[model samples]
Target: MALPSVGTRVTYPAGDLIARARVLHVEPVATDDGERLAVLLDTTSIHPVDAGWPDQPADAGVITVIDGAALTVLDAIVAATDGETLHLGRDIPVRKGTEGWAFVVAHLVDAGSAIAEGDEVETRADALLRASLSRGHTACHLASLALNRALADRWTKDPRRDPLGSPDFDAAAIASSRIEPNGSVDRYRLNKSLRRAGFDATVFTGEYGADELRAAEASIDDTLATWIAGGGDIRIERDGDLLTDRRQWAADLEGGTARLFCGGTHATSLADLGDVRVRLELVDDDGTPTLVMTTRAHAPS
Candidate 1:
């Protein structure tokens, strides 16, 4: 079968939990666990884990046919091909949107499965898991914005700003970000490079470090509390529906509307994220000072 010429159409961004699709391609792949079949679809509601910036993991789901047994979707990952070769996850060579490359979602199923190309199927993502992840992703962004606002005054020089006009400390020093169920964990590198970028790292290292950290955490919590109380509407805006299209997380925040480029599912409103808070701690990673922010939110009933 010929590889798809265009990116997969994704509907998860709109909080879609189910999709009707046709199998475009299927390839048997050998892995450490066992042989798995990679099923490519014409369209999907299952969210795939992006190799680049894999903060949020793939959605848990299954694919089925009419009155047929469901095939458990082991995982969904971003894959790309150049007509001649299909690359999966970290194996993808070129950046997204490269000319003549088709980026698609590969849903892995167990080996020796009965599914085949051209078959009509239904993709269903787990509602509870999706809701938890959506809430987590939304809380992740809100926490990062709050953290930036809390540490805005710690910059010694004029720095780049985020959507809310605060210093872009999160973007500047971020080492990694991971979204968990109902929460997120983000790490920031407070090294010489960050100091050179006008960030006053001493406050996080000096004798008053503990006190400063507490104050920052408190401030962020307060900001989050106010934002949640405001009950802002959350939405994902996109230019197109293709997998490679640009998308943004736009929220009608307290002060103003804030939009951040993102490629993950999210909650529908601030009210969906109940009681968001963060705990900040400093850790030494091979002699480098790293600040970790652990965010948590009470699941909405």
Candidate 2:
């Protein structure tokens, strides 16, 4: 089969978890243990883990053939290819949306799977896991906005503002973000550079103590509660349905509408995020101080 000239059409952004698609191509990828088969579809609802910024993991799912043979998808990843070669995940040499390149979602199955090109398959994601991840991703974004507002006074100079018109602390100081089941962990660096940017790192251990940190946490919780109580609508706006197109996560909050550039899935409304809370901790990484924020979302029982 010939490699696709255009990017794969993805439906996951619309909160789709199941799709029926035709196999476009299949190839064998050599792994450390052996070789694995990568199946590409004309269209897919399975969310693939991004290689550039892997904050949210891939969706767990299975592909079933028309003949009733179910093949478990081991993993899903972003794959890019030029006209000459196909690159999987981190192996790609060029950035996404490069000229003469096509980005695709590659579903990895066992090497011996009986699936082939031109096969009609039904792609299904684990609904329970998808729902949990959606909640976690939504909570992660909300917590970041609340944290920015809480620390808005810390910046002496005007920094880049977030969707809520507050100093973008999460964007400036974020080192890593990981989305987990019903929760997320974000790490921020309070090094010398942040101090030069007018952030008062000394507050963590000097003037600001555990009491101050607790107060900030409480403020974030209050903001989250207010937003959730409003039962605002949430939706994903996209420029197109292709894998590499731009997508924005938008929510109608109490103050106004907030939108942020994101590729992960999210819940349909703030009401779906029940009892959101965040815990803040300041720790030392070698000689540098780091701030960790752990956010959790408890679904309504």
Alpha-carbon deviation at 27 in model 1, angstroms: 0.2
What lDDT score belongs to each candidate, Candidate 1 first?
A: 0.93, 0.92
Candidate 1 lDDT (Cα, 0 to 1): 0.93
lDDT of 1 at 157: 93
**Alpha-carbon TM-score of each model against the true structure:** 0.98, 0.97
Error of 1 at 34 (Å): 2.3
Please report the candidate that would top lDDT against the real structure: 1
The residue-by-residue lDDT of candidate 2 on 1-301, one tens digit each, is 8988888899999999999999989999975657889999989999999989999999999999988689988888999888567799999899888899999999999999999999999999999999999999999999999999998888878888999899899999999999998989999999888888888776676765687689889999999999999999999999999999999999999889999999999999999989999999998889888889999999998
- Candidate 1 residues lying further than 4 Å off, grouped into runs, are none
Any idea what lDDT model 2 has? 0.92
Error of 1 at 262 (Å): 0.5
